[model samples]
Each structure stands twice: as C-alpha cells, then as structure tokens.
Target: MSRIGKKPVPLPAGVTATISGQSIEVKGPKGTLSFKATDDVTLTQEEGAVAVQPRGTSKRARQQWGMSRSMVENLVTGVTQGFKKELDITGVGYRATMQGNVLKLALGYSHDVNYEPPAGVKITTPSARNDVIVVEGIDPQQVGQVAAEIREWRGPEPYKGKGIRYRGEFIFRKEGKKK
Candidate 1:
C-alpha cells in the first residue's frame, strides 16, 4: 500500500475542493487550481479532506495513487499560499532590474537580456539588492521553471563561480592552472 496515498489531504479553512470524475479543483483566497488524475487512481472528497486510492493492485495503479495524492495536495497549497523562487547573480558586472513587467539582466554580455514573465508569473528585482531576482506564481512548476530558465542563461562556472544561480545553491570551486 502507498503510505502517502492513504493519508487524506486536509482542507484548511477558507479553502474549498471539488472533485468531478478524475479531476479535482481547489479554490482559496489566493486563486484556483485544478489537477486531473490518471484513470488508474480514484479521487474522492470526504469531510474536510480529499482522498486518493488505486483502482487495482497493479504497480502502475499504486504509483498513480501516490502521485495523484501529491498532486491534489499541491493544488491546495498552490491556491492557498502560492509559490516563490529566488535567484542570486554573482559577478563583477552582473545585475538585474525590473522595468515594468520586464526583467533586464546584465551578465557581462554585449547586450542586456530582456525577459518577460508569462501571464501567471511575476518577476522582480528588489531595490535593496540588484543582484537578486524573485519569481512568484500560484503554480509551483511555473515558478521553478522560470527560475531555472533564468539560471540557464548564465550558469555558474567552476573557476570563478560567476553566473546566475538559486539563492542557496552551492558552486564547486576549481583551482586555476599553474603559471
């Protein structure tokens, strides 16, 4: 049996969940989010909680059971608290600034990189720190994807560690060649 699937997702106050067929929709103060489960799993709404169970004893069904449960949980959390990701720029001339909804980045490139966030996501460069970038959205996947895309533009190098990276990420240092 799947331990995570067995536990029902509790609905917090001011949050409501509706399950129809194989899909579940959750609405909260922040926003509304929906998730569709595979046919191998069954979704149900109980008293102040949601539950997931496999349709059969097959391995795929069991896997879907746990996955569906987690998806439902994420939906609840997304609508209630939303998600956020922070990136740090490291270099002598690297910096980030927000112009309206667009993000302007200077990573020692010949031209500034202009990034426009998608409809549901928001990108900002805090005035206190121009080297820090903040990504926020109701969907955890979108927030993480945007942060990853920003990091991909200038990944940290092993020698100088100059690039964009997650705020708490660690970069392994490498020694320089002998003179």
Candidate 2:
C-alpha cells in the first residue's frame, strides 16, 4: 500500500477542484492548474478533499497511485501559494536586471547574457540587491527550471566561490595551491 497515496488532498478555503476523465483541474486565487493522471489510477473528490486510488494491485498501478496523489497535492499548493526561487549572484560585476520580460546578466563575460523567461513565469531583481534574483510562478517545475537555467550560465566554482547560487546555498571551499 502507498502511504502518501492514501492521504487525501484537503481542499483549502477559496480553492476548487474538478475532475474530468483522467484529468484534474484545480483553481485558486493564485492560478488554475490541471494534471492528467495515468490510467492505472482513479481520481475522485470527496467532501473537501481529492483522493487517488489504484485500479489493481500491480506495481505500475501502485506507482501511479502515489505519483498521481503527489501531483494533485502540488496542484493544490501551486494554485494557493504559488512557487518561487531565489538566486544570488557572486563575484565582481556579477549582476542581474530585468528589462521588460527579459533578464540581462553580467557575469564578467565580455558580452552581456540575456534570458527570456517562458510563459507564466516572472523574474525580478529586488531593489536592495541587483545580484539577488527572484523567480515566481504558479508552476513549481517552471520556476525551478528557470532558476537552474540561470545558474547554469555561471555555476559557483569552488576556487573563488563566485557565480550564481541559490539564496541559502553553501559552496564548499577547497584549499588552494600553496607553493
């Protein structure tokens, strides 16, 4: 039995969910999101919560049951509180700024790097620190993807500990060469 799959996703106040075939749609103040579960699981709404159950006692069915439940839970949370990721830029002259819908970055490169966020996601640089970037969206995956893509441009290096990293991320420092 799947422990997580057994727990129903409680429908919080101001949040609504609908089930159509294998698809579940959740709407809340933040936004509306939908998820389509595999055929091995069944989806339903009871009282003020969403539930997922497997069709049979097979391995795949059990797997889908847990996964489907998690997806539904994520949808609920996403539509309610949304998702956000913060990145900090380190190193001399490393900064990030928003121009319209694009992000302009200066990571010590000869030329500036420009990035355009995909639909439904917003990127911003707070007033206090241009090097601190915040990515917000209703979808957690998209927010994380955007943050990762930005970090890929200038990953933190152990030697100088300079580059883009998560706000609270800790970079391991290695001993430098001592002649």
Candidate 3:
C-alpha cells in the first residue's frame, strides 16, 4: 500500500475541484488548472477532499496511484499559493534586469542574454538587488523549468563558482593549478 496515495488531498477555503471522467479541474482565486489521469487510477471527490485509487492490482496501476495523488496535491497548492523560484548571480559583473517581461542577463558574455518568459510565468529582478532573479507562476513545473533554463546559460563553475545558480545552492570549489 502507498502511504501517500492513501491520504486524501484536502481542499482549502475558496478552492473547488471537479472530477469529470478521467480529467480533474481545480479552480481557485489564482486560476484554473486541469489534469487528465490515466485509466490506471481513478479519481474521486468526497466531502472536502480528493482521493486516488488504483484500478487493478497490476504494478502499473499501483505506480499511477501514488503519482496521481501527488499530482492532485500539487494542483491544489499551485492554485492556492502558486510557486516561485529564485536565482542568484555571482561574479564580478554578473547581473540581471527585467524590462517589459523580458529578462536581460549579463554573465560576462560578449552579448547580453535576453530571455522571455512563457505566458503564465513572470520573471523579475528586484531593484534592490540586480543579482537576484525571481521566477513566479501558478505552475510549479513551469517556474522550475524557466529557472533551470536561465541557469543553464551560465552555470556556476567549480574554480570561480561564478555564474547563475539557485538561491542557497552550494558549489564545490576546486583548487587552481600550481604556478
């Protein structure tokens, strides 16, 4: 038995969930999101919570059971509180700025890197700190993907540890060659 799958996802106040056939739609103050589950798992709503159950005793059904439950929980959290990711620029001249939904990054490159966030995601560089970039969106996956794509442009190096990285991330330092 899956411990996580056994627990029902509770709906917070002002949030409503509707299960129709193999699709589930959740609406809240932030926005509306829908997910289609596979036939291996069944979705149901009871009282103020949503539940997921496996259709059969097959291994595939068991796998989908827990995954479906987590997906449903993420939907609730996404609509209610949303998701956010923070990126920190570290270097002598590394910086980030936002202009009309476009993120301009300077990572010691010859040309500035212009990144345009997708429709639902917003990227912002706080005025107080140009080195910090904030990614916010109702979808957690999109927020994380945008942050990762930005970091991929200039990942932190082992020697200097200078580049774009997630906040609170640790970069292992390497010693320089002997003269």
Model 3, position 25, has a per-residue lDDT of: 98
lDDT agreement with native, every candidate = 0.92, 0.95, 0.93
Candidate 2: misplaced stretches above 4 Å?
none
List candidate 3 segments past 4 Å from native. Answer: none
Clashing pairs in 3: none
**Among all windows of ten consecutive residues in candidate 2, which has the lowest summed lDDT?**
122-131
* Per-residue lDDT of candidate 1, residues 1-179 (tens digit): 99999999999999999888999999999899999999999998889999898999999999999999998998888888889998999999899999898899999989999998998898988757699999998899989999999998999999999999898899999999999
Using TM-score as the measure, what is the rank order of every candidate, best first?
A: 3, 1, 2
Q: What is the lDDT of residue 48 in candidate 1?
A: 97
Better of 2 and 3 by lDDT: 2
lDDT of 3 by residue, 55-106 (tens): 9999999999999999999999999999999999999989999888789999
